[model samples]
Target: MDTGRKQNLKEARTLQIWNVIYDIIEVVVSLIAGFTANSSALIGWGLDSTIEVISAGTLGWRLHGEIKGLDERRVERRKMITLYVIAISFALICVFISYDSISKLISKETASWSTVGIVILIISLAVNPILIYYKRKYGHKLDSPALLADAKDTFICLYQTVVVLIGLLLVKWLGWWWADPVAALLIVPYAAKEGWEAFSKAQRIKNNIDRK
Candidate 1:
């Protein structure tokens, strides 16, 4: 590998490591706040964060293999697997969020206002854009589709942060009890779209591998 390629891989791996750490904290804090406030949207977001950890780890592993001079076939195989995993994970997240949101809507559950949830989301709003920018930049630098897909997932999380924050605010201030679940429901279509895109990319990779 050339010097530039090696440097890009190293930087990408470092970014993924930071992503994993941030997501682990997000998972714990969001879940705690979700349960405390009885907010389904917050819970769904927390679950999504869990998948982000897996996505980052998968890409990180792929980058590591490249840095270690793994065989071409093995690296490609790992890339294909990473895409498949990301696709399936997004599908699962869509299903879970859909079910939970609809149930909450039907039951007319009103989540309590959580100061912690608001604080965490505010922090995320500030942080996710930086992550997204670099992830995309390095993803392109390394020419890694899996990394690009992971960046898209991070973008989804940023979108969810905005939507969830709005929902929580409406619930707290305007007595819009249904807003939270509805906000969560809105995430479903986008998640499904990303999932399908990932799956399609994986299929293409599989076909290429088969031809070789």
Candidate 2:
């Protein structure tokens, strides 16, 4: 094997492991913060992180794993089907979030301050963009769709941070209670659009090898 190929494989493996750890930790923390503050945007964004976890899992398993023969494509196809199900799960979560945010907006929900969670998100916002640039740089070099997907997920965190920041700012500066959920509502479309693209890509990959 080429040294470059070996390096890419190592990078991919390292990235996948970090991704799994990052998503698991961050999403759990975000959910805790979102609920603690009753912030729709925060919670909605947390759900998005959960979806990314599924995407990363699929990317790692398929992109790095082995398929020895044509017969094994069936197994790979089944695994990809599972990934597609993850995509469906993302859509369902998005719908629920959109509905919840809208309902909260109409009902005049209050978004409180979670000092710790906000601090956590602030750090996440600071760190993610750099990672994305790096991931895209490498993913593009290797033509690794998995890394591309992970890069997108990292960028989504930046977007979610902006949305959450809006809500937080409105609450902090203007005392506008509705602005938080509204900001979250605005980002739902972003989440949906990205997830749809990822789902389509996964479906394409699966369909290419799926005999059934």
Candidate 3:
């Protein structure tokens, strides 16, 4: 393999490892924040992180076994499996959040919990964009759609964090109970978009300019 390809794979492997760590951390944080705030969106966010952990693990394992471009039947199967699992997981989370948020909206209850959630939101907002940019850099360098899709998902996470933060602040200050559920509702489109991206990854790769 060329030196450039070698370097690219190495970077992809490292990025996958980082993603694993980040996802684990995210799941933990979101779980705590969700329960504390009684926010279904936050709980659903935790579920998404768990799926990311699976996706990152699969990517890392697949990348580790590859010398360059992967052609083995097992590796290809693993990638496809990972893609399906993540796609299903994203859809599930989106549906759960939508249902939960709508219920909350109808009941008209404000979310409460965690000055710490706001703090977590601030940190995620600060960190995710840079990680996503690097993920995109590695994706372009490596011609890897999984990495790019994961980056896009992280941006959604960032957007959710911002929305949740706004919701929390409004609930705290304006006494707008609806703000919290509204914030959760705002995430639906992004969640579905991420789900579609996960589902489309391999198909998109297959339908390349050369294939078409």
Candidate 4:
């Protein structure tokens, strides 16, 4: 590989590593805050962070393969596997979030005001855009579809942050108990759509590989 390409892979690996670490922190904090506040949206967001960790890890593995000078077929196979993993993770998250949110709504569960939940979500809101920008930048630099797809997942996280923040604020200030579960429900369609897209892309990669 050229020096420029190698540098891009190294940088991408660093970013993915950072992503995994940050997501681990977010998962713990968000889950704690979610349970403490009885907020389904926050809980779903935390679970989403867990999936983000998996997605980043998978992408990191593919990046490692490239950096290690894996053969072209092996690298492409790894990329396809990464996409399939991401798609499956998204599908799982969508199902989980839907069931959890719907159960909460059916049970008439009201989320209590949580300062910690609000604080963590606010921080996520501020941080995700920066992550998204760099992921897209390096994804383009490397011409990696898997990396670009991961960037889309980050964008979804940003959207979830906004939705959950609004729901938390509404619950705290306006006594809108339904807003929390509703926000979580709103996340499901987007997750399903992205999952399908990832799956389709992976299939296309597989078909091309088979042809070759």
Candidate 5:
């Protein structure tokens, strides 16, 4: 490999590693505050964070393969397996979140406004768009589909952050507690879409392998 490509891979690996660490912290904080506040938005954000970890991990593994000169077929197979697991997991998360949000709406339960969630969303807003910018830049430069896909995932996270922020602000500022579950329900279709995309990608990979 040329020095430029090698450097690019190194940078991509570093970025993925940092993504993993950041997601872990977000997962813990979001989940804790979510349950404590009974906020479906925060809980859905936490679940999405978990899926981000998997996406980053898959990209990291692909970068590792690139660096180690691993067999292309073998790496693709591993990638398919990872994506399948993620698709299944995300589908389950979507179902759970949908059920919780619908139940909360039906019962007319009000989630207590969480200052912590507000603070976290603010931080996420500041951080994630910047992450998306770099991920897209490097992903295109490196010709990495996995990194590009992860950039889209980061974009989704940013969108979720904004939605949750609006929901929390409405609850705290305007006494619109129902906004919480409604905002969380917005996450469901996006989650299902992503899950379907992943599943389709996995199937395509399997078909390609079979053809080979």
Candidate 6:
């Protein structure tokens, strides 16, 4: 491989590794705050972070294979497996979030405001935009669509956090108990969409490879 290609792979690997670490911390903190505050949005957010971790890891694996000069077919086969797994995971997230949000609604469970949740939201809002900027920069530099797609996913996570923050504030200030579940419910359609996209992309890749 050329020097430029090597550097790009290294940078891409570093970015994905960073995402894995960040999402690990995110999953722990979000889940803790979610259960403590009885916030369905937070729980759904954490679940989404878990999917982010898997997605990032898959990208990292693909990049590593490239760096090792693996056959393109081999690398693509692995990616296909990863994409299928991601598709299933997203589907599971949709079902999980839908069930929880609906149950909360039926039970009339009010989300309690959490100082910790608010604090985490503030931190994520401050940090994620910077991460998104770098991810997009390196993604373009490397000309890697997978990296670009991952960047998009990061942006979505950032958006989800913003919605959750707004919903929590509404619940606390306006006594809107349904706001939490409603915000969480919003995530379902997006998750389902992502699942379908991933599956379709995987199918396309598989068909192309099979024709070869």
Q: How high is the CA lDDT of each candidate model?
A: 0.89, 0.75, 0.76, 0.89, 0.88, 0.89
Across 45-135, the per-residue lDDT of candidate 4 in tens digits comes to 9988887898898889989999999998898898788778878988998988899899988999999888888888888888888889999
State the displacement of the C-alpha of residue 115, model 4, in Å, after optimal TM-score superposition: 1.8
Error of 2 at 177 (Å): 0.7
Candidate 6 on 1-212: residue-level lDDT in tens? 89998998988899889879988888889899999999999999889888889998998999999999999899888788888989999999999999999999999999888888888888889878877888898889888788788788888888899999999999999999999999999888888888898899899889978998
lDDT of 3 at 209: 25
lDDT of model 5 at residue 159?
Answer: 91
Model 2 Cα lDDT, one tens digit per residue, 61-179: 65555322235675467456656766687788779788988898889988897786687678778778867877898788778666776787778778888778778878978999988
Better of 2 and 3 by lDDT: 3
Residue-wise C-alpha lDDT for candidate 1, range 62-170, written one tens digit per residue: 8999999999888888888987987898899899899888888889999999999998899999989999999889978877777777777889899999999999999
Tell me the tens digit of each residue's lDDT in model 5 across 1-212: 79898898989888889889888888888999999999998998889889988888877888888888788898899789878988997899899899999999999988897778778788888888878988998999998787898899899989988998899888888998799999999998988999999999999999999999
Against the true structure, what is every candidate's RMSD? 1.4, 2.8, 3.2, 1.4, 1.0, 1.1
For each candidate, give its TM-score against the true structure: 0.94, 0.86, 0.85, 0.94, 0.97, 0.96
Q: List where candidate 6 sits over 4 angstroms from the true fold.
A: none
User: Which pairs clash in model 2?
Assistant: none
Which runs of model 2 end up more than 4 angstroms from their true locations? 66-79, 210-212
Better of 5 and 6 by lDDT: 6
Which pairs clash in the backbone of model 4? none
Please list all clashing residue pairs in model 5, or write none if there are none: none
Q: Under the 3 Å rule for N, CA and C atoms, how many clashes does model 5 have? A: 0
Whole-model alpha-carbon lDDT for candidate 6: 0.89
Instruction: Name the lDDT value of residue 125 in candidate 5.
Output: 89
What's the CA error at residue 73 for candidate 5, in Å?
0.4
